[model samples]
Target: MVPNVVQKGEVIAIDGEWWNSDPIKVEAEAKLSGGAPNVSDAFTINGQPGGSYNCSKSGTTNFSVEQGKNYLLRIVNAAVNNHLFFKVASHNLTVVAVDASYTKPYTTDILVLSSGQTADVLLTANQAEAKYYMTASVYTTQGFYDKTNTTAILNYVGSNSSATPIGLNIPEFNDTATLVKPCEAWLRRSIQWTYGHSSSLLLQHIRCLYHRLSFTSPVEFNYTGDVPNTLWAPICGTKVKVIEYNATVQVVFQGTNIFQSDNHPMHIHGYDFYIVGEGFGNYNESDHNPFNLVYPPLRNTVGVPVNGWVAIRFKADSPEFSCSIQKFYKFVKFDDVATTLDVSKGVLAERVPVGRDIGG
Candidate 1:
């Protein structure tokens, strides 16, 4: 169990969902097709499609709140294959925690969460005494998605429950900037940890490691730009990168346009790495743009922006075998390989199972 770093008022749990019609039948077909999975019938909140959905009004999830009180909204995106943009009408959310790690309170009007990511946000019931719609919609650059959004109700104490809740405006289905803007604030670690290294050490050591990994790329074209038809077929195999214990490891994940330009959320088990830097387009190692080594946000999963890249750093201290893989795949096939961290004294150690064996 995780403990809150700051005051967590009344806690309210919320989660994103994907309503399916005959999930078993379609899942079987999706695996065989080697293509994008079938789009979900509806986006839901806590299993209910909400009032906006046809025949779901009576089952809408509603929460009663008193004015001047604070409620902590713990939201998790559990959709099978989609990122989400969530918001409450007329209320700004103060993001205090993410992926079970507390972050310095950063207020934003919108929240973007990729699958398997969790955010703890504080919502002050300071708005007018009325019913407000809490909604979640798709945040993707992909062509296919569940167009219908999910909704719930934030009913202030004594507000008319029968009243039609005021709805909130969500971003356009494919709005990439809105999705990235919320993350620009760069959530900082609320508490300091001693694992961070000096910038000079990072450049000298991590740069050499990155140089070795960069060459592993089959052929570098315009990574974030158009890809030739010949490059659509991905190279698949098992590869392991051995690192020394307590060594700082930095990885740059580049999102390519091989099949379709889209965001990829990468996750590494058994490690909460610092998200040092990220930007659109291919990452340049010598750009000299500084990484936030001082108080970077630590997360186990990070979303690589559509046609972009992200750099993460972590201390490879855990002796256990760990794997890193993309959390969601739409355009890509089931060709992802598990990159393991076998931290031993220049020798491969015995592998132990701790996370998902996604690479088969």
Candidate 2:
């Protein structure tokens, strides 16, 4: 039985898995940087570097959930890097909200979220078992950055239980469209809002915030295995996306890959916007126009396709600060500035970075 809460229940997931079994077991690289042996040059969870090099240094945790109780897990990917897959063993997570937007109740064994996305899941401990394992692992569409499988114990009070953690089907580290892409297409916006469909009249007044905050993947270091090259750095800037208050805004993210081709999970700070359009190759003017303004799935964070692009739309009606974070596979990460920037009272925007161009 799903609870009734308008604009309060949506679901999103995260995956950025890596762990150092041995802190000093860095692999010698063909590239000039981060080669030989260095634990500091690795992917991380929370903030600590992770590696498959050391098994004794794992960061598994323990937690308890009372039986017959309904717990809402507000999961957030505040990490500046990597998308992650999360789930509780033997429990069907009922997703209720995503990025502060309410969504229809949907159950699944595993949930995938990119960096900066949030999912509010209702955990109902209805099973007879008294213990389970909650897991969060790396989700890679391009290549593996880390394979850290962070686990936590879910123990129920006042009952019998096993010492071993229960098993779950958290999607494989590399299953993108196989396990992830369908989930991305499955999310639909709530029906409680006014005008469930977008009208062309409303579409004509679209305030397109079209600008390419472009970054390219390098081609110098190509380490192909399960692990991606831990050498080449993807460069980006601290961009402030300024928009209007109480007005509809749409933004497109175009991705480029030269060295290593990968996908990016773009997250927002304040509100869940409609994921109107997305595809491969560059986002064109004629082809990508006239978006699916008719009740597209709304999410705070969306995936900019691997070596492609994604377009999203939302209204800057909420009076608060928000952020748009861009977490590329091994390179770029953006700040959580806000969902919409209110530059009213004749104030337009923060000083434009010199040599920067505003296309919209």
Candidate 3:
């Protein structure tokens, strides 16, 4: 843990959302819409749909806070298929960690969490003695989506019980500018990885895996721009790139317009990597020159920006686990196998051992 970097957690709160939907119906809808699942019937907090949702006011998730104390909220984006913008009315959040990895404290008015990502933020109870709304609203960059915002209650001790809670103003559903703040500011340390951009059918990918074959089709045009119908098809296959143990590697995840340009929450299963650099448009090799190697945000999952790219790096040292990277984007049915690190290998006579993992 970073010494003295984390704030005091006088109170702890678990923030997450639950979806009210039928599993069988949701699956059928995805198949019918080419993997697009039906919008969540309700966005809930701690299983309560909050005051704004139907007659759930009495059941809204509430946390009592004392004046001058701090509450550490462990926020998780448990939504099935949406990136969410989280914030509290009249409160600034100091982000201390993400995905269980400590990061330099960065304060902001709002936080954008892609599905499957987690954040630890400290919220100080310094506002007037009243109730306020803690909210999560959908954040996207392309196509139609559910624009609903869910809320919970942040009640100050001794506040009027019947007083109306101040509401929060979330960014617009397609607010890409607001989403860039956290992605650019998250910091820690490490080297890099670039993930290829494409979508493919799970059946075709599995077929490649079964035959021990690799298929990686690259889009040479403007990835973030208007993509033709010819480039919209899935690049089906299991593409693997092996990395040696203890090697500093860079993997860049490039966002494409094949189907739509949207934020993808890319996650590495067995490693915490440093997000050294990220930007919009196609990635240039020169982008590596400005990487924040000294204080890059170390995380297990990072949101590859809409129509942009993100570079992550880690040393292949985990000698027992084969890491796999998965993109937590809505409607994606298969994990892209872009980079596989071979770390299970033991040290040879003169060569050091290597780690194994895949990035897509």
Candidate 4:
């Protein structure tokens, strides 16, 4: 949960407990403070320091809140395999931002958060209560692993007391049984264009060969099919090859029974995009047509509809470092059999044409 403070350097303590289990670990670090030391290295539960709890863990950490101002509370779900929804038990927390984007401030009783997702909240402590609880619980979304409620008590000194702050009751959430069906369908469609059966593979190989030839010779070519043309236009003609970043991206997600399912949260590194549109049951234009094509929420990641297609667009731009195009190149095979190209001609040509040129 986010906290509202007066200024920098105000000491604040956070405390909480995991419901029905061993206390969950709590670790808070200052992101701005070089290396951002783990300010909250300790753990606690239900006002008690340590005890034998079956399914939850508790902890507390102290930090200096700035004076006369607004600050961002960046929370990460380091929990191994649980989806958590967070809220301030007695306060109206304004979600001004999400995953680092400045969204319209929306007040809610609880914030539904997923594993590996981060949320920042804005809280104003204009009272003299001195202490209140920030609550986090598991969402019932599709494929959710852990099921427990956790609470973090935030204490503010010299603050007025209020019987109830604002939003307290945590709403019910279902991630798996409600959100996975659409996401799965979208994922299936996305991979088909890139890594489908025979025809798709042949097309990909042809495109890769074309790119390699363009790099060595002063030529340009374009080929299109299930693969979108706009996505490959820029690299249609290029020479110099550079390698930089490489990562293994995998999505091994599950759903409930697979029919009437829930959407899955899909994320990609390096860029953000809009959902644009989605559809279910084979993406038929006539059958499934309702979609917001105008102005959807621009997000780094999105939840694809159950049993449908999720389309996203991202600019292939990376200023920090170039990503290796080799992964795509490696997947291209000439046919059912793999053939090796003889590079002796090119290598010998490079050696003979440095300072002088031979002409008839």
Q: Name the top TM-score candidate.
A: 1
Candidate 1 Cα outliers beyond 4 Å, as residue runs: 1-9, 18-20, 187-218, 330-337, 350-353
lDDT tens digits, residue span 1-360, model 1? 134533425555455555356777676677788766688888788888898766888999887888878778888888877888999999999888899998756889999898888998888888889999998898877667788888989889888867889888889988877887777787322212111111100001133242243324436666655566887665555555566667777777766666556677777777888887776666666432566767788787788777566778877777756545444564233634345555555557667535755643
**What order do you get sorting by lDDT, best first?**
1, 3, 2, 4
lDDT tens digits by residue: candidate 3, 1-360: 334443445444344445467766776677666756767666767777788766787888898988877778888877776788888999998888888888888889998877777888888888999999998888876567765667888999999999999987779888877887666555322213334443221111111111232334354676766668886676555544445566665667777766656677776666888788877666777767767867788888777777677777777677655566665555435433334444535542322222233223
For candidate 2, give the lDDT: 0.51
Off by over 4 Å in 3: 1-20, 187-219, 331-339, 344-360
Q: Which candidate would rank higher by lDDT, 1 or 3?
A: 1
Taken over the whole model, the C-alpha lDDT of each candidate is 0.70, 0.51, 0.68, 0.36
Error of 2 at 281 (Å): 6.1
lDDT for model 3: 0.68
Candidate 1 positional error at 274, Å: 0.4
Lowest summed lDDT across 10 adjacent residues in model 2 is found at 195-204
lDDT of 2 by residue, 1-360 (tens): 364532322222233334345432333231235332232223333343322235423544444666667777777765445666777878877777777777656777777777667787787778775667676776654443554566556677765654556667667776645444435434233111111111000001124354322222223221221223343343333434455456566666655443445556665444667877765554456634445665576786776555355677776665444443333332211211122234232355444332113222
lDDT tens per residue, model 4, 218-240:
12222111334443323332233
